[model samples]
Target: MTGGREGRVAVTMPQLGETVAEGTVLRWLKQVGEAVADQEPLLEISTDKVDAEVPSPAAGVLAEIVVGEDETVDVGTVLAHVAPGAPSPGQRAEATGAPPVEPAAEERSPSPPSGERSSPPAGGPRHRHSPRVRRLAHDSGVDLASLTGTGPAGRVTPDDVERAARHAAPEPVPSPEAPVSVPTRAAPQRVSTAAATEPLPSLARSSAPAANRAFRTLVAEVDVPAAQWVGSSDQASVPVPGSAAAAVVAAVAGALRSHPSLLAPGAGADAGDLAVSWSTGSGTTSCLLSQAGELNVGGVAQRLLAGATAGEPPPGAGFTVSLLQDTDVLFEVAEPPPGQVATIVFGTPTRRVVVVDADGSPGIAIRQRSSVALSHDPGTVSREAALAFLRDVVRRAHSRA
Candidate 1:
């Protein structure tokens, strides 16, 4: 936060992450002259990694907006200004350098006499409507003042305008020469009790066919001891149980940063500014990290834990990592959701006998290992690229271990 002219305080674009240098203003939750509470969501912003709501730094009236919606600015740039105290309407107008607005006709000192014509109410719906909503109403030929507002504080929302426009749309008249046919109703089919009793397949299961058509899966084995060591070591930033998961996440993040080709076309332009979805027992959460490629195992763990705890997932993640620990399943091909490019599934680690190279010869030894599988969209990512990425993830994980 910075200081503004007069007694107003400046709200600048915050540095969201280590690698993020800029952000785009998405929307203003509070317009100029509106009183906002401290920590209240003031606006929405979009960066390469994630979209988030920025909160007000102090309780005050929003004095001015220096940055408009959709404008991109560098970090630390002043975005707006907020006056220190709750000002009256006239004071707000003066602080914003705008002329004081007159009261609505209904609230005027003297009402229009003898049916004399009076101007429309100053506080009509248009006054409270956002620029976007007003534009939409104008384009859709909807009357703003007549519609009942369903939004907060009786504000006319875009949806309400759209709904009114749809309802007011003129019906087409049929020509006399055109033949009209009566529509016949079809009989409803009866469902058998057994069929109805059968459990419905989950959304992922039902979409498997379509997702499989464009996706490819690759599986690899990782040394579980290395991951466990990183997880339990003092260097680990997250809890012991989640340390391994963090290691995997860090590896994936590094791989994505190193090989942008692994991501869908437009998704890679941001380079290291990437966000990944993490699926755990609680739910899937989108985690955004700063300089993920340079972050140590602990740093990755901390970010993942924070995101999971927040519960509210940010949008625009093309890659996902799912943890399926504590299960016997060696590896499972997890399908990516719509708009997602790929998913990595980690299986439970288990002790297994494997050939170990000792001094000068190979010998049988017991070791902990886990199966990891990568499910990616073949249409966007080639098999070779996917395999290379998977290999890179394993290599990075081992490097940290």
Candidate 2:
């Protein structure tokens, strides 16, 4: 399409990490001939660690669907292609020698051997090898024909074998020392498993215990002073070594560092509940785990946002047990002015939502008039003075509303 990839953007499956071996195609949201935008989800993919939505790297007509659903492919495979604002095939008569095919029709097209839509010749499937896969084969000087089956329906396994067979591959000729072997240890091979963690102390902080039923929700929120907002005061001359969010993360990380306490109650030990909350300029989150010996519910929002914004995730942030702290929060749901929650992590106004896409992130505007300097040596103010500040703001805001 588009004359050999000119102006085309490649939507490749991300290689999350070295330990991450490969992924499976669970489904495709968009398909060939579909109109798509940059960063829009093109397909749903699953790796060992996650079930993730694969986004288009750029906007264009989803020019081609290179991989099939339920197919497993290695990282860096080009799952789909997007050209810069290219019209659907129907609109651009010159591309693909055909017009834009309807998105719904193409996406629902069944996988090969069923022959619903047009089928490639019996010798091979129309869509099989990914563009990146082809490139890698060429670069590694691999003969795909020689590779044996590992993937679905005899599809060639990628990368791991490619890299291994290419780099650390057995040389055409070998040295004698390479065949040396060590004696096996004289012990039985044992498989060990660690138990699931006990609930966090903060999760247990609820005064009223919620019943475990079919489904439910929990809610919490926090406030921020305008002066401490991210954009406040040109945000210091130099980048601070740590963000306010990072501080919150550090506090929570500290909680988990007490591994024995975090582990669930077992082996005759009695556990108590611990309640901790984290808050930062980014947002606020509360944690309640019913366990004994710690209640570190401090700066949860700060902990999460710091980890999210840190550009790298901290330990324990990846678990489902971990949750986001909402920055621009709205407890009451409404329509239009405050749109419905998007299916996935999406940004918003009013409440700065980092979306669940990332681990971390802030809010609220407080006026200088609401606060006053303390006169005593210890820098403390009287209770009556604090009440006046709260009542005054309530009156000011109520009058405005």
lDDT of 2: 0.36
Worst 10 residues of 2 by lDDT: 334-343
Give per-residue CA lDDT, model 2, range 41-89, as digits (tens).
Answer: 6778889988787877776667766778998888988776666664544
* Positional deviation of residue 323's Cα in model 1 after best superposition, in angstroms: 1.4
Count of backbone clashes, every candidate in sequence: 1, 43
lDDT per residue, candidate 1, 38-110, as tens digits? 7777888999988888888887777789999999999999999888765566656766676535442234322
Worst 10 residues of 1 by lDDT: 188-197
State each model's CA lDDT, in order.
Answer: 0.60, 0.36
Best by lDDT: 1
Residue-level lDDT for 398 in candidate 2: 29
Candidate 1 residue 109 Cα shift, in angstroms, is 98
